[model samples]
Target: MPVLVAVVLVVAGCAAAATRLRVAAPVLLVVVGALAGLVPGVPLVEVEPDWVLLGVLPPLLYSAAVAMPATSFRRELRTISGLSVTLVVVSSLLLGLFFSAALGLDLGWAVALGAIVSPTDAVATAIARRAGVPARVLTLLEGESLLNDATALVLLRSAVAGAGAAVSVGAVALDFVLAVAFAVVIGVVVGRTMLAVRARVADPTVTTLLSFTVPFLAALPAEAVDASGLVAAVVAGLVTGHRAPRVLTPRDRVSDALSWRTVELALEGAVFLVMGLQLEALVVDVRAQHGSLHLVLGVAAVGLALTVAVRAAYVVLLLRSARRRVRHSAERSAWLDEVEQRVERRVQHLPADGDTRAVRRVERFRARVRQARHDLDYVLDERLGPREGVVIVWAGMRGAISLAAAQTLPASTPDRPVLVLVAFTLAGGSLLLQGLTLPALARRLARPATADDRASRTRARMHALLDEVAAREGQDAPRVQVLRAQRTALLDALEEGALDPDAVGHALDVLDAEESGLELRGEGLRTS
Candidate 1:
């Protein structure tokens, strides 16, 4: 208990200091913990692999997914998949080969090591967010981090299971497909069921409490079936976040956000702190096992270099594809416009009040056409260029996940101590080398001030739309009613892709604040 208290205090202290010093908290906490670990007489802090993978990981991922904007997630799905799945597989295979040659390890065990380090941790998103990178770039990074863990872990399991034998590629592929399919089903069922139950509850506290169980509820069952529990948790979160606006009350939404933010901070801080504290023990184990710590460090350096090189090359390719997509979407948008015009002309020529079903079908077709065009426009507006690509490449740093996954390697695995040390060194080195330098790189590549002009225009237009809605409601209407009407209009615009989600989110917050203030005043009057 004392040790736990001390750890929390240290985490809190480091976080506070990082905030005051304008530094990334993860980077600061890791440094402090590392230095603390080396102090004479300090207790060796060892973390169980299960504690991290089962306890810390789900909540961290769930919180992130709940906060992620689903529209952006869907929009960048292709890029995210390329990075999270395709890149992970390619990097793991290449690193496996490299490690086999460099470390004189068996192929399967080397590949297992590769898989342990493959996924970019969600901590990278927190770092990138602090750097004020473009929203599209942040989305890509967040999406990649959210989904890549499943890919890496699945690969690791396969490699471990077939360490000395020929692992069938077809079997691995089939297993992956089934795991994902099952996880998705589990996630959807859990998400919708919880949302339905929460909708009937009136108390904000109760709803928030229910929200806490969501990740575990989604993850446990998925894992029971040998599926990707992390993916299940992520899916549940995305569903909740996307649907919360419609199903949850304003108070409930605010409560969940505030509480989850606290949980995220505490869990994330502890993970990094623990990461740093474990370094000395890992080194000790390497030494006790007669492993060459110096040689392992060199191997970690090579692994880090390979990871970055692969990411940079993949990101460049993604950007090229994005450019081509923009051009293709533009052409498709024009073609749709022409088709809509012709369809409208034909509809106008039809006899009035004739074939009502046909008229309804035509309207439905037109609605689909309009939606398609809006989606294409969204794609065009959020195009990724070379500058964004550079940020994405540099921001792909490893963190807690790599270290935790490394610890999960079987005890009997060959050179276990040496492999674990290499993983720790790679994670720490990546954090220090990439995390510390990312902010500066992000600033240098940041979009010019002129870029905000479009955002300003969008906000102004959104506010104007709200004002018009309020005017229609009249000054005689209840204040709450007026605010609710404005909110409805804002959400409608968001759904139509006519207003930016960021702008709409801000507008909704304003509405919530006003309503909350009104409720507070009413309660005060009643008490008085």
Candidate 2:
């Protein structure tokens, strides 16, 4: 009954947020969960730690990874690597040291706490997306959140071992490397195998079922081999996502997308709500235990503070350095542009009008300049920028994973209740404080799209759609191409300034409806 109610609340919260309120869905779900907890006969929702790490993490990670833009992810690989591995390790060590001093925890236990809370949650990334953050920035955050788990878990195992025995830095590094390598190999092999299987299966229903199991297929085997299941899931998702465009039919793609979106929406809401509803019970449990409330709260406050501080410093330094490099390249491009323009003009106006060599050289130089400028802009846009840096730094809200990690600690561990309570506090506090404000921050930081930029993008999209339509080779191909041609002509006129922006937008909207009808008819005819 509670589960049913929770699902209803999740659905309701989303509908209300979409149609009426400006509030975040996660926030609303959390509030609903808390109020429901106060109701008579409502049972407490408890999520097991192993269930989270084993069952929940895989699909969520896979879905996010698959949805992520591969091009943007590759471009920001360096940033992602720095945040996932280097930042996780650095934050773990620093916070571990802090916990040891402030909470009087053993070094190993303190480090365990550090590892638990180091990675930013997927919920935070989703919130950022809802807040209208730039796509590239969201990619970087998503990439970081996906990979950081493997690193944190490796560190966590080492920390747990250190509780009773000595563990070396080299050992930890070796474990991390091996875990990632094994997970990669497993993921690729499984992904390819699945692709081969998918190619043989024509039924979308069966294929959808196969696709749903990919995350587990990737995760379980890797985990069985003592590798990082999370990494395996991510890699599998990436490969599957990359293949989806080529392998899956339009209907399959549509169905798959809807299925994953539904799953993601439910899991995200339930996870957040469950955490909120459990907060009061956890707090009470902590108070009933033989620990100081001040101590538990203090550790949480200090740990969250340190986590935010480290993240800020890291973002600032990385963004500044990236910006500097981009600016330098942009300056060089400007200089090259000037020289190229001058040379082109000189060649064009020369007395020897048929100086082919000079003309060719000028054109080549112009191409070179254009390429350099494009690269510079792409780097700043897709990799790092000051405005995006500000938002990313603040989007480090923790989620269910932190609580699960804390709960996974051994029963023999000291101050277990207090530790769990502190972890819960940090995760909840971060969510409420960061998740609630992220949308407003993104709005403030987002650069408004210019009219020219918007128009150019729309025109380019129309051209791409036309090309896709033309590529079709069936009984309906000619008709589709002709219809697409009309759309293309409309866009071309809009681009040429024959139509106003408003008129162009209206035309495109009509074309969208027309295209949907064509696609539906095509599907129906094929099925018939």
Candidate 3:
């Protein structure tokens, strides 16, 4: 218990130091852990793979998914899937072949090592976020990191199983499909059921408690059925986040955010610290096993180079595609406008007392056309170019997840210690190489002045919206009522794609604060 307390203290202290120094906390924590491990009396910390995979990962992913704007996630789904799924598969396979030839290892074991290192860490993307990378780039990075784990882990499991027996490509593919399908089902059920329960509960404390159980509730059942628990947690989080605004009270939402942010910090900090501390022991283990430390380091370096090269190539293609889409946006917009006009004409022809079902269908079709046009406009406004592409490529740093996944390898697997060391070195090297340089790169590739101008305009619009709501609600309406109306307006703007999600989020925060203040004042008056 004392050791645990000390670990927490160390993590908190390092986080504070990082904030003060304007450094990435994960990078700082790892460095601190490594230096502290070298102390004469510090005990060797060995983290069980289960501790990280089962305990730490689910909540971290869940929190991130909840915070991810549903609209952005949907907007970037195609790009996100390409990175998280296709890129991972390609990187893992290519790296596996390279490792096999370079190290003379078995194909299955080599592929397992490849899978371990393929997924980028979301925690590391905090560096990119702090560096002021554009929102679309951050969305891509965050979404990739959030969803890629399932792909990598499933590949890892297949590789490990193949090592002992003949596991066919068909079988592996089937496994992945079933895992995702089952996890999605489990996640949706758990997410909706828990939201229903939480909505009925009056106490914010109880609501928060139920919220805490959500990730695990989604994960545990998925894992029980040999599915991807992390994916289940992510899906549950997305559902909760998308639905919470309508179902949960503002206080409940605020409480969940505050509590989950704290949990993310502590858990993420511990993972990195433990990652650093374990490096010394891993080194010792490889040495004890008569493996050349230098050889493992070389392999890790080569592996890192391979992954980076693949990512660069993939991102270049993505950028080219984005440029093409932007180039042709005017044509697409015109076409969409024509389609919308036709729909409007059709709506005009429909009788007011026409068949209700036919009218509803047409209305839905018209809404879809409008939404498509809005989405296209959003794409044009935030087009990615070479600079954004560079940021995306460079920010693909590996961290705790690689090390944790590596540690999960079977004990009897060939060169297990060596493989673990390679993963550790790769993660450490990536963090130092990429995380350290990302901020400078971001500054160089900074978004244009127009981006800031757009943001300012959005903020002005938000204020205008609030004033309009106030005027409509009337001066005699309660302050809380006015705040609620403002929040509803902000949400409406967000849905219509008329406001930036970040701007809407800030406006919502202001409304929540104002409402809370009014409630407090009312309580004071009643008491007096």
lDDT (tens digit, per residue) of candidate 1 on 258-309: 8998888889999999889888988888888775577899999999999999
Count of residue pairs whose backbone atoms collide, per candidate: 0, 0, 0
Global lDDT of model 3? 0.88
How well does each candidate superpose onto the true structure, as a TM-score?
Answer: 0.94, 0.81, 0.96
Query: Comparing candidate 1 with candidate 3, which one achieves the higher lDDT?
Result: 3
| lDDT agreement of model 1 with the native | 0.86
**lDDT by residue for model 2 (413-492), tens:** 99888888888888777877887788899888886674246456756755665556556434555554555555666544
Q: Across residues 150-184, which tens digit of lDDT does each residue of candidate 3 receive?
A: 89999999999998999999999999999999999
Give the Å error, residue 315, model 1: 1.2
The lDDT values for all models are 0.86, 0.76, 0.88
TM-score of 1: 0.94
